[model samples]
Target: MKMEDYTVEFCPWCCEEVVIHAVGITACPSCGKPLAPCSVCWDAHGGCREPCPYGCAGAEADEQKPVTTPPITQEEIDFVMANY
Candidate 1:
């Protein structure tokens, strides 16, 4: 799906509102935090859960990965500077 098809979700790390695609990882526009949709699970109680019960793809692998911010490229810096 295209970027526009994804819902705007909050960054679990920074609590900033941002748009991240349902598949793959994307950086938060506000805090530059990277996340994949499967990184956190939304429970029926409307609370976040780690390791989704529904077995979302990459959920187990994501749990094994360390939380680290990817290096920002010049293009990203320029885009942010130009826009904000």
Candidate 2:
């Protein structure tokens, strides 16, 4: 089912299933923080992805992984400056 079709939800913080009908409420109706989404891991999938920084608090237990990013070196910066 699509994420939009989900009306009832389980709060990650409080671990309680909540029936959400309003669009304005973002937090868990039970513990307020149960449904908090990780800003760094949210994607177009309508839910948190793997290696969630928030540890997937209320979703499931999984081994945490490291976040990797491309390294920027001074040589690369200099080359860009020379061209642009």
Candidate 3:
């Protein structure tokens, strides 16, 4: 089969098996859950191209996406307990 015929199938979020067929290039299905376009690899995802990092579950893009939530801090927990 041709390369384009192949699909980079993968659910951007749930890690489900989603097909990135020739036509599926634009973006994944925007179902109930929020969707965001791949940040690092924009439209290039077309043609079932390179694999995505974190895969994004196809949510909407944003100027500021933490991408990485802050690690839990002991001081913060302590304060919460103190107040309680």
Q: In every candidate, how many clashes are there?
A: 0, 2, 8
User: Rank order by TM-score, top first?
Assistant: 1, 2, 3
Model 3 accuracy (lDDT, Cα): 0.35
Flag the better candidate by TM-score, 1 or 3.
Answer: 1
The regions of model 1 sitting more than 4 angstroms off are 1-4, 38-84
Expressed as tens digits, the lDDT of each residue in 9-68 for candidate 3 is: 444456653323232233333222222333324555343224444343333552123323
Residue-level lDDT tens digits of model 1 in 1-84? 233334356565687655544445556656665565543346677765655543434344443343344443445445444453
Clashing pairs in 1: none
- Of 2 and 3, the candidate ahead on TM-score is 2
Native RMSD of candidate 2 (Å): 16.9
- lDDT scores for all predictions? 0.50, 0.41, 0.35
lDDT of 3 at 76: 38
lDDT of 2 by residue, 1-84 (tens): 223322455555566665432222344445544332243236788677765554544434421322222232345434433443
Candidate 3 clashing pairs?
12-57, 13-57, 35-58, 35-59, 35-60, 36-58, 36-59, 36-60
Ranking by lDDT: 1, 2, 3
